[model samples]
Target: MILGEFWRGLKSGIVELLSALIAAGLLFALGDSAILATITLSSFSSELKSESVLEVFLIDEITQDGIDSAKTYISSLSGVSNMTVKDPEAAMDEMSAILGSDMTDVLGFNPLPFSLEVRFEPGSCDADYLNRISSGIALRDEVMEVQYASEWLDNLEKLTRTTYIITGILLALVIISSLFIFVSLHRHISTRRRDIVRNLRLLGIPPQSLIVISMMRAIFVGIIAGAAGVGITILLWKLCCNYVVTIPFLTTGFTVLAIAAPVLLALISLLISAGRSQSNLFASGS
Candidate 1:
């Protein structure tokens, strides 16, 4: 009988229901997109960090013994994943590829210095860490200079931090706005059905039943809104993959959570709203 009243109430408030649904759906869609974008960017940043390498150039007069000693020392450094010694010839070839011409032929000699290309393990390198390692490497007797993209690393870190902050703010805004919409819709429905609720109360229908009815209706609206949100999110993801850089789709777990979160939020909102409304009803009835 309570559920019957819930459906009756739903059919009576079609306009209010549609308004809340659209509002919540758009908010959820935006939140999901932010989450997915953040995940993709973080993954991409990690891959780049893994590939980041420190270049240690050797002094011109360094002997083979010095090279071997340097290699052993660098290999023993903490977080050193791999190191490759690039001879002057190899360095020259790399420069040639970059310049699209043979630097050795132009200069009549390979002025490129021998260098050690060193990569660190994933999650082990950051701007400050690279700076410290490079500084320590430069202090070696046979080392000419140590170079790494410290600026780029700093920028990447900032970008990642900013992405998380923005995502957090977006989610907070969505939740707050969703709560407002839910409460407003609940009040509107209660006002419209006040007489019916009074009659039910006279017939011995407990106030708690009214709360349950409101919560159930909210959950039903939430499921529909969640579906609409996911649909919009999929469409946006496809557009991004087609025009922007490709990103991995949300996994099954994330997709399910994305759809379920709004429902949970809606249920909670109705609980709070219904609790307050029931309190008012009791006060008025007495």
Candidate 2:
């Protein structure tokens, strides 16, 4: 008898089931995209940080000993990842390579000074920190200047921050909209089964039992919809994986969440709908 009722309910609500599936699928896709975007941004940020290098030039009057001492001191500083000292001759050679000719041959002298290329670890490439480091380095009598592309770093930071803010906003909106759709559809189903529910109540079937049946039907719908949605999302992700780079650690976790979120949301909405319907039924009886 229970099986018969379950089948009947499933057939009656097939349209609602399909609607919920499509809506949940879309929400899951958007959520997955947002997560991937965040991971991509972090990867890009790390790449930028790795490429960041600060050039510290030494005063021409400084000796080799001064340069060696300065290199040792800077290498020991906190937040300094790596440091390489380029002698005046090496600097001139690099410049000559770029210009396709030796400047010393044309001008009779190499004007370039010895410099240290300093690279910082990820998350330490900020303006204030760089400024502080530069100030400390300038205090040394052998140091001439500390230069980096601070503007470019600042701009990248701003852009990544904006992308995160926008992604968060869109994700929130999609969740709210999905929940609304689920609740609205559940309420519609409840109204359609109102007469049958009233007859069941009159037959001495407990309201709790009736609500359980409704919840069971909702669960069946949720499971089918969740599976379908997750399958579609995984398919799309696999298709795009070759074209895009994503973090391996986060991919599995996010995929699991995407699969579970829709079913959980559907069950919760159904619970709310059933409870509300039971309350109304008792109120009308009283």
Angstrom error of the Cα, residue 180, model 1: value is 1.2
lDDT of 1 by residue, 1-286 (tens): 9889999889787899899889888989998899888988888887788788999999998899999988998998888899999999988888889999997777888887889999998877777778887898899999999988889988998899899999999999988988888788877887778788888888989877877888888888888888788778888878867675544757777778876888888888877776766456566763
Model 1, runs deviating above 4 Å: 76-79, 97-109, 206-208, 240-247, 280-283
Candidate 2, residues 1-286: lDDT per residue as tens digits? 5666667666667787678768877776777667666777867876786678889999998898999899998998877899998988999989988989999998898898889999988766666577678889988889999888778877877778888888899878867776777777778777777787777777877666766677776666666655665566566767877664543434556656765676677778877766675456566872
TM-score of 2: 0.80
Q: Local distance difference test, per candidate?
A: 0.84, 0.75
| 58 Cα displacement, candidate 1 (Å) | 2.1
Candidate 2, residue 174: CA error in Å? Answer: 0.8
Q: After superposition, how far is residue 133 of candidate 1 from its true place, in Å?
A: 2.7
Q: Which of the numbered candidates is closest to the native, going by highest TM-score?
A: 1
Error of 2 at 259 (Å): 2.0
